[model samples]
Target: MNEVRHFWLGISCLIFKVSKTFRYVDTDNELEKQVGGYEHIVVRCPIKIVDENIVETVQKLPRGTIPGDFLDAIVVGMDMLIKKFGSSNKGKTHLCLITDAQYPIKEPYEGTKEDQVDIISQQMKAHGMKLDCIITIGKLSKAINQKILAENDHLLSQFSRKGVAKMRHVGTPTSLLGALRTRTISSVAIFKDEKVVQGSSEERLL
Candidate 1:
C-alpha cells in the first residue's frame, strides 16, 4: 500500500531524519569562513515521479498549465519542510532535482544542458555543501557535458572522510513499487557498496 514510486533506473529512495545530536560542527561564522566544517544545513530537492500515457485531467489544462501546477506543488512542499526544519543558514541551500532525465527543460535561450548544469554547479560551489549536484542516476540522462561529472567528483571529494559515513545513504528510487516501499526515515551504510544498510541517527558514524 506504499504510495511512493521510485525512478526506473538503478536509483534507490529514502529520506534522512536530520538531528542536532549527529549534526556537524560549524567553524564557519559571519566573521570567518572555515575550510572544512559541518553545521545545520538546508536543501531544496525537486522530484517528479515516473509515468507514461498522458492523463485526461492534464489534457484539460492549457499547454503550459500542467507543468506549472506540478511546480506549484513542489514549492508548497518546500514551505512545509522549511517549517519542520529550523531556519535556513543565509541562502545556502542543498538542492537535488530528481527528473525523468529525458524530460527537456525549456531554457530561456539556446544554451545546451551543459550550460545550465555549469551555471548551477557554480552556484552550488558558492554554497559549499556540494548538495547542489544534480543526480541524473536513472534512465533519464541529461544531454550534458561529461565535464560536469568531473566537477561533481572533485567537489564531492571535499566531503570525504578516511573511513565510514557519519550519516545514512538514502538513495533515489528506480521504480514505482520501490518508491512506495522506501522509508521517509533514516537509513545508512558503512562502506558505500558493502551492504545496503539502514538505521537511525543514534547509530552515529556507521
Candidate 2:
C-alpha cells in the first residue's frame, strides 16, 4: 500500500554531543513513537544499526570516542541504506533519509566531500529518494547559517532544483520537536523508467 512506508534514519552525532542526540530521540515523545517504523543506523564515524529497536540502539552507542566527521558518516550510511533497500517501484520502495545536519571542523573521509555529495545527490534523483536534514547549528551567526543551508540545498538538489531535499534548523530539544513534526513522508518522488523509452529516430547509436 502507498500509505505504508519504510525509513532509514541516521544519527550523526559529535563525541561530546552524542548523549544529547540520544536523549532527544529517547524522550517519550512523537519522535520515539514514530521511529518504530524505521530501521535506524547510528553513525559517529563508525556505524551500527540497532536493527528495528530505536531506543536500544541509542543506548548502546559507545561513548568517549574521538570526534568524527558527520558528513562522511551521513554519505556512507546513506549509501548502505540505498543499496540495501532501493527498489524500482515507488509504492514498494520509498526511502527517506533523516539526519541532524551537524558538520564537523575536519572531514575524516579520504575522497573529496564534494564528490561524495554530488554522487549522493545524483543517486537520490535517479532512485527518487527524499532527504531531510534537521540542522543543529552552534556558534554560527544567522547569516552564516542561511548561507550554509542555501548552499546545501543547491548541492543536494543537483541540477533539477526539485523539492526532494529539505533542511530545517533545530537548536534545542524543544525546537527538535517542531523539526520532527514537519517531516512528512507523503512527498516522496515517484520514479519513472527512462530506459523503457527509446530515443528519437533522428538520434543515431554509433
Per-candidate TM-scores read 0.27, 0.44
What CA RMSD would you report for each candidate? 15.6, 14.6
For model 2, residues 6-100, the per-residue Cα lDDT tens digits are 11234211101122232334222122244432112233322221122333333344432233233333444344444444553232222223223
Index of the highest-TM-score prediction: 2
The Cα error of candidate 1 at residue 70, in Å, is: 11
> How do the residues 1-206 of candidate 1 rate in per-residue lDDT, one tens digit apiece?
01111111111111111111222431111111332222221111112221221122122212211111111112222333333333432232222222222222234245754454454445334433222112324332354445643553333333333111011222343331222222232332110000112333322111
Q: What C-alpha lDDT, on a 0 to 100 scale, does residue 126 get in candidate 1? A: 44
Candidate 2, which segments miss by more than 4 Å at Cα? 1-65, 89-112, 138-163, 182-206
With candidate 1 superimposed using the best TM-score fit, by how many Å does residue 126's alpha carbon deviate from the native?
0.5
lDDT of each: 0.24, 0.34
